[model samples]
Target: MSAATLRAAIAAPAPAWGLSAAQIGRAATLALHDELALAPKPGLVSFVDSGSHDDMDAHTFMRSLFSLRRYFVRMAELGAAQVPFAELERSGIAAEARMLAATGGINTHRGAIFVLGLLCAATGAAQALDGRRDADAVREHLRRHWGGALDARSQRAPTLPGGIAARRHGLRSASQEAALGFPVLFETALPAWDDARRRGLSAQQVRLDCFFSILAVLDDSNLAHRGGLEGLHFARRAARAFIEQGGAGQPGAPAAAWSLHRDFVARHLSPGGCADLLAAACFLRRVAREP
Candidate 1:
């Protein structure tokens, strides 16, 4: 689909699932806000501070989210109509352009735009199929509908910094991760989120635990891009150690996370891929909770 066609689609009347699309879009934006508000996210930007990043901060993220609001709604509409993956990709490209424009060329939510956009599309498609908005249904629809295209996309040579780093280090790129249906998001982060809630942890603690769980396991090409193999290994080890010590549920967990945050800042390492997954997980959680 051409960019002009996508723009016209956006300006067109709402689809059958228009209300649901709007809700899905709001959920995605709120999930990003949830991520941004959470503090001491090691090597990530938040309301508390711009951990390890000097170029962008909470305000920049807010702007990116604002720019992406309509994009998510449009993606949902496209998915409900069962448009081709190319359409979704075009929407994402347009959203990324808007995000860059909003952030003044800073890449605040590029990864989120791709990751959460797919999830939103999947959710819309799933709802249109049977009114089932659960995570399993959404994921199944995503893979069933667009998995082949994603795999093909993963095979293409990448020019982005994170993709280049992944290729150089022999790690999975974001495209590769999405091609596999986002195993870290569906398997690791989502389960960790549920487990934390089952353990009666606070909302913040659940997010923290889920975030660390993703950091522990994901190849995190962003971390590799920023800190190399050594930096990535250090981050995985630190996250593992945090989980071993009872995660965010344990005593003094916040203090421990703060200490790790400082260490990550000192090393200039940012697990941006993990952060995006965390936000995706948050979106799934929100959608699942809705009737």
Candidate 2:
């Protein structure tokens, strides 16, 4: 479908007022920015620290995020049109090029570009159809529309390190996760965030709880790539321990989280995949809050 057709379809009458594609796209972008700005991210880049990645800092992430603004908008537009999966793949490739250029050939936010871009599109598609805008509905739209395509894409030979690592380690690739409608995001990360909020936890505490929840469960290839099976196991155990100890609800949780962060940095392990899911959780939470 053409972009104009998508815009027109999206402009059609819908239920109670909701965010437009542009607004959804912008919210997705800001969600990513918020994730980056979140400090003490446990070996992940934030506004105050570099985490485990010396190659990319918070400034580098900002540039990558800025470069992706139009890409997210276009992805949302494509979904609004209900375009073919091939078209979305083509757009993603182009956006990756822009991301690489913006980051001066570095791979900052590549995973996020894929995951969050799909979400932006799925959200737009749902809204265009006047469907529900909650997390389950958006994810259902993704599965109903693109599950097969995503599965087929996952079957293709590996290209990037994350994909290669996933294949070599028998972990799920990002495409597979998308094909499954992002079970980790829907079942794990979002619930963890919501549970923390329901418990009246602080924002940082909520994020901590959510991140650890993701870490304990997500088969993060970056962690595998950096520290192999041993590193992945260690990270999961640490996160699991944190969660069992009442997480952020515990009085000493912040200190424990900091200790885990230091350990991750020392081992050069970064749960980048989990970090992406955390950002996605934020995006979905924002989408759900809209009228």
Q: Model 1, 155: alpha-carbon shift in Å?
A: 0.2
Structural similarity to truth (TM-score) of each candidate: 0.94, 0.95
lDDT of 2: 0.86
Candidate closest to the true structure, highest lDDT = 1
lDDT of 2 at 32: 91
lDDT of 2 at 203: 82
Candidate 1 wrongly placed segments (more than 4 Å): 1-19
- Model 1 earns a TM-score of 0.94
Worst lDDT 10-window in candidate 2: 10-19
Cα error of candidate 1 at position 182, Å? 0.3
